[model samples]
Target: MSTERDRDPAGRARNARPRDALGRPLPYGAVGEERAPEGVVRPPDRALAEAQELLDAGRPFHAHEVLEDAWKSAPESERQLWRGLAQLAVGLTHAARGNSRGAATLLERGAGNIAPYAAEPPHGIGVAALRTWARGLASAAAAGRALDLRPPRLRA
Candidate 1:
């Protein structure tokens, strides 16, 4: 089975389905599909800034895309940081879409992945705070409460 990474950013395969700005595949007859290009990993500062902007703008799904690029391009030592951030963004996206179970699962998993970075995150990202925030979100979702929590800032 082809994974999401196997698909083109434009979702243009022989059986291309449309996608949203977040790169989410739309249903077969869905309209208004956007062609959001996949993100490229830039310098750490720039990538974090861009991803934070997207998160603050209520676009966690887009943030996930940005972070995914970072995860793909980061050094081995920092891969977990970027991947965790991406997962956190995806968790938020699930929450916003009213998938509480998925939100909880991803949030907890993201927090676990981010735990090691809590002491000294790259670019001064508040990894500890982010993990705490993720935990809170997970708890809320587990309790069946849909929250509209603000995204955490990347800087300390």
Candidate 2:
């Protein structure tokens, strides 16, 4: 057997997925195949812009799809930020569909995931707004208050 340091330690571990060049977990290429593409990120800027556009259009589910691939291509540490944004987008989608409870749950999970960025969030979805929305939902839930799940009005 190869030494722990010399061998692929992660390969021997159970439930361990392979990583890409940037150490980000790549999605399974197929049902049971796990492989990274020859390239890391296809088009980070385009992906980000599309995601932003979806968000601006109040289409969180669509935005989530736009960002998933880019997030997978990012480094491991960056994944959380992207994942959090995706989750938040998902929550927003559910809210738009009139699923307040579902939205609250997803938003809470997203806030938890992005807690590290609470002080300084990324460009599009920052931690501050996420936290605020999460807290509002939590309070509404606890107090049996009705919530308006509409997205905030964007200033022109």
Candidate 1, 9-101: lDDT as tens digits: 677654356666444677766773443246575899988988888888777887887888989999999999889998999999888878899
Which residue segments of model 2 deviate by more than 4 Å? 1-45, 120-125, 138-144, 150-156
Residue 75, model 1: lDDT of 97
* Model 2, span 1-156: residue lDDT tens: 222332245554433344332223444441332332322464655666666666676566666665566678867877887777667667777666667777778777876777787665555445676667766764564455676655531111
> What lDDT would each prediction earn against the true structure?
0.82, 0.59
> Which one is best on TM-score?
1
| Top model number, lDDT | 1
Worst 10 residues of 1 by lDDT: 32-41
Could you tally the backbone clashes for each prediction?
Answer: 0, 0
